[model samples]
Every structure is written in structure tokens, then in C-alpha cells.
Target: MPDLASLVTVPALLASVFFFIAGSVGLVRMPDTLTRIHALTKADNIALGLLVVALLPQVGSIADAAKIVAVWIVVQISSGAAAQLMGEVALAERDAASSGPDQRGMAGGRDA
Candidate 1:
């Protein structure tokens, strides 16, 4: 008979994989940069948490699982910061292009 742990682990792992696939699709199909970042960060973080849960039973010690969870937390924080930074950069670029001086130089100047 299959052990209870094995049974539970299987589904959790599978769900994690599904989340990964969904996130990937979001990245490919989303219309814009910010939306893509939202998909990747949120979905992948959930998937990572699920993966850590599924892996806990298979690991030799509770300490190992705790370590995995800690890593996931760190990753989530860093990735979130990265995504925010990228969004800000994109916005700045957009603003600069939209508002900057024209190719003709000063606003009152005419073609040479």
C-alpha cells in the first residue's frame, strides 16, 4: 500500500508544477511588463511554497525543510524588490521619452 505521506506529496508536487506552467503562460501571454512581473512573482512564489511543503516529508530532518522555507522567503523578498525596480525603470523611461526635449533641441529653436 502507498504510504500516506507519499500520496499527499504527489499531489502537492503536481500542483506546484501546474502553478509553474500557469506562471510561464502568464509571462508569455500578458500584454505588458508590469503584468508579466505580477504573474511571475506571485505565481512562482506560490509554487515555491507548495514545492517546499511537498518536499518536507521526503527530507531527512525538520531542519532541512525549515532551511528550504527560509530560502523561499528570501527569494520572494528579493524578487519582489527586483520587479518593483524594473517597473520603476520602465516608467521612468516612458516618462523621459514622452517629456524630453525634442530632436530639434530647445523648445523655441528652429531647424538649422
Candidate 2:
């Protein structure tokens, strides 16, 4: 019979792949930058976490599993920060475009 770890690992990995694909689709299909970032970040984060979970059972040592989890955590933090920064920039650009040209040069639509 197949081992329990193998059974668990396979499904988790497959789910992770599914989420990664969903994220890519969202990136292409979303209407705007903010929604795109939201979809991609959320999906990718879950996919990465599931990937880490799948890998934990297969690693040879505790240290290897710890390293995998650490990498996942780091990627999660960095991706979230990057997504927030990108969203902010997109909002700023959108606002700039919506505002009249004369207001665009000024900070916060005021004399600066």
C-alpha cells in the first residue's frame, strides 16, 4: 500500500500547482492593477504555503524542513510588501491620470 506521507504530499503539491495556475490566470484576466495584485498575491501565497507543507514530509532532516518553512515565510513577507507597494503606486498613477493636467504637477492637488 502507498505510504500516508506520499498520499498527503501528492495532493498538497497538486493543489499548490492549481493555485499557482489560478494566480497566473488572475494576473492576465483581472481588470485593474489593484485587483490583479490582490488575486496574484493571495493565490501565490497560498500556493507557496501548500508547497512548503507538501515538501515538509519528504525532506530527509528536520533542518531541511525548517529551511523550507523559513523560505516560505520570507517569500510571504516579501511578496506582501511588494504587492502593497505596487498597489500604492498603481493607485497614485491612476489618480494622477484622473486629475486634470494642471493638478497633476502639484502635490495633493494643492500648492506645494
Candidate 3:
């Protein structure tokens, strides 16, 4: 029979892989940029965190685990910020595209 370490790490790693696959499917099936970002940031980040957790038991020391956790935390924060920025840009692009050159400014003394 396998040991406790294998039991924990195996499932955790499997879960991480599942999340990554789900995120990829979501990205392809989704309609637009905002949705894709949602899939990636939410699903992929979870996958990354789980991957870190799975590797934690195999690391040489507690300090290595701490470092992994720190990296994961940083990734979470940065990904959230990036998603927000991408969302804003997507909205801006949509607005600009809808406006068109003529609608943007029809001129002060001209009629539609």
C-alpha cells in the first residue's frame, strides 16, 4: 500500500490538473474577453494554489512551504488587479467601437 504523503499529494495534484483543464474549456467556450479573464483568473489561480499545496509536503523544510504560500498569495493579488485592468480596457474598447468616428464628435455647429 502507498503512504500518507502519496495519498494527499496525488489527489491535490489531480485536482489542480482538473481545474486547469476546466479553465481552458471555459476560455474557449466563453463569448468574450471579460469572460475569458474570469475563467483564467478564477480557475487557473485555484489550480496554482492547489498545485502549491500538493508540493508543500514534498519540500525539504517549513520555510520552503512558507515561500510557496507567499508566491501563491502574490499571484492571487496580481491576477485580480490584472483582471480589473483588462475589464476596464474591454469596456473602454466597447464604448469606443460603439461611438465610431462620427458619433464621437459631430462638431459644435453641425447637424446630424
Candidate 4:
């Protein structure tokens, strides 16, 4: 019979692998940078969370689990926020590019 620890670890590892694959596909198939970031972040967050949870049983300590969870939370927040910021920046750049060169204060235009 398979041991409990093995059972837990195996499933967790499999889930992490699946998340990684999904993320990779999204990164490749998505049409834009913002969409790609969304996919990548979701995959990374799920994979890391699963991996950490899998390690909890092996560590066999509450303190270790707490530390891992804390780190995971930090990673999740930082990555999500960074992705949002990047998306905003990309959108701003796209808008600017589409606006064309500025015509203000040129050819005797008003300069107020």
C-alpha cells in the first residue's frame, strides 16, 4: 500500500506540474502581454502554493508551515500587484503609440 505522505506528495507534485503546463500554454497562446501576465501569475501562484503545502507534511512542524505560508502570501501579493502595474503601463504605452506625434505648439499653434 502507498504511504500517506507519498500519496499527498504525489498528488501535490502532479497538480503543480499541471499548473506549470497551463501557465506555459497561456504564455504562448495569449494575444497580449497583459493576458500573458494573468495566465503566468495564476499558474505560478497555484504551483507554488501546492508545492509549499506538499512540503508541510515533510517538515512536520507548525512553525515551518507558517513560515512557508507567509512567504507564499508575500509572493502572491507582490506578483499580482506587479502584474497589474505592468498591465497598466502597457496599456498606457499602447494608447500613447496610437495617439501619434504631438502637434501642439507647432506651425504657429497656441502655446498657452
Candidate 5:
């Protein structure tokens, strides 16, 4: 018979895998960079996070759990920052492209 730990770990791992698959599907199907970021960050992060938490029992140490949590937090912050930057850059480029040639240069009597 499987031990309690194994049973728990198996289900948690399965859940994590499902989350990852869902995230991947979202990434493929979602339109726009912003939506993709949402899919990748939230879905994948949650999946990986659950996996880490599930493994905590196996780790058998408070220090390991703390380290995992710290890593998760860092991932959350960095992914959010990256997504924000990507969105900003995409918007800026879109704005610039739609704006056509620089009117400021034309007004200043400089070559565009």
C-alpha cells in the first residue's frame, strides 16, 4: 500500500501538471501580448507554487520551505515587472507607429 506522503505527493504533482497544461493552452489561444502575459504568469506560477508547497513535506525542514517561499515571491515580482515592461513597450511602439512621422521635427525645421 502507498504511504500517506506518496498519496499526497502524487495528487499534488498531478494538479501542478494540469495547471501547467492549462497555462500553456491559454498562452497559445489568448490574443494579444498582455493576455499571454496573464496566462503565463498567473497560471504557471500557481502551478509551480502548488508543486513546491506539496513537496515541502518531503523537504522536512523549515529552512527549505522558507527558501521555496522566497523563490516564489521573487518569481512573482520579476514576472510581473517583466510583463509590465513588455506591455509598456508594446504600447509605446504601437503609439509611435500610429503617430506617423514626427511633427515636432517638421515644426522645428529639422530633417525627419
Candidate 6:
């Protein structure tokens, strides 16, 4: 029979792969930038977490496991920040596109 680590690691890795594929699909299939970012970030974060969990049981030492977890944490922070920035830019562009030119105001104001 297979060991406990194999049982845990195999399923977790499979789930991680599933989520990563979901994120990729979302990135391509979503209608808009905001929705795409939403899907990708959410799916990818879960995938990364599962990947870390899968690897933890396989690592040789506590330090190796800790490093894996730390990498996940760092990626979580960076990806969140990047998604936020991209969302802001997308929203700004969307708002600008929706607004009328008159609302933008004249560059020189009322000329005599």
C-alpha cells in the first residue's frame, strides 16, 4: 500500500492543478478585465495554498516546509497588490470611457 504522504500529496497536487487550470480559463474567458482579475486571483491563491500544502509533507525538514509556506505568503501579498493596481487602472479607464466629453471640461475655459 502507498504511504500517508503519497495519499495526501497526490490529492492536494491534483486539486492544485485543477485550480490553476481554472484560473487560466478564467483569464481567457472572462468578459472584462476586472472579472478576469477576480477569477485569476481567487483561483490562483487557492492553487498556491494547495501546492504548498502538498509539498510540505514531502519536504526533508521543517525549515524546507517553512520556506515553502513563506513563498506562498509572499506570492499572496504581491499578487493581491498587483491585482488591486490593475483593477484600479481598469476602473479608471472604464469610467473615463463612460463619461461624456463635455464633462471633462475645456482646457482653456471660456475664451473672450
The best candidate in terms of lDDT: 6
Cα lDDT tens digits, model 1, 77-100, are: 898899899889867766665556
Clashing pairs in model 1, backbone N/Cα/C closer than 3 A: none
Show model 6 residue runs off by greater than 4 Å.
Answer: 100-112
Pairs clashing within candidate 2: none
Ranking by lDDT: 6, 2, 3, 1, 4, 5
TM for candidate 6 is: 0.88
Which residue ranges in model 2 land beyond 4 Å of their true spot? 101-112
Best TM-score among the predictions, by candidate number: 6
Worst 10 residues of 4 by lDDT: 103-112
Q: lDDT score, residue 37, model 1?
A: 85
lDDT of 3 by residue, 24-61 (tens): 99989998888898998789998998899798877878
What are the Cα lDDT values of the candidates? Answer: 0.82, 0.88, 0.85, 0.81, 0.79, 0.89
Error of 5 at 21 (Å): 1.6
> For candidate 5, what is the lDDT?
0.79
User: lDDT by residue for model 4 over 1-112, one digit each (tens)?
Assistant: 3377778888898898899899999999998887898899989789988888677677667898899889988998898899999999978876665553453423543222
10 residues in a row with least lDDT, candidate 6:
103-112
Q: All candidates' TM-scores?
A: 0.79, 0.87, 0.82, 0.78, 0.73, 0.88
What lDDT does model 2 reach?
A: 0.88
lDDT of 5 by residue, 17-58 (tens): 999999999999997677787898889988988898678666
Q: What's the candidate order when arranged by decreasing TM-score?
A: 6, 2, 3, 1, 4, 5
| Best of the two (3, 5) by lDDT | 3
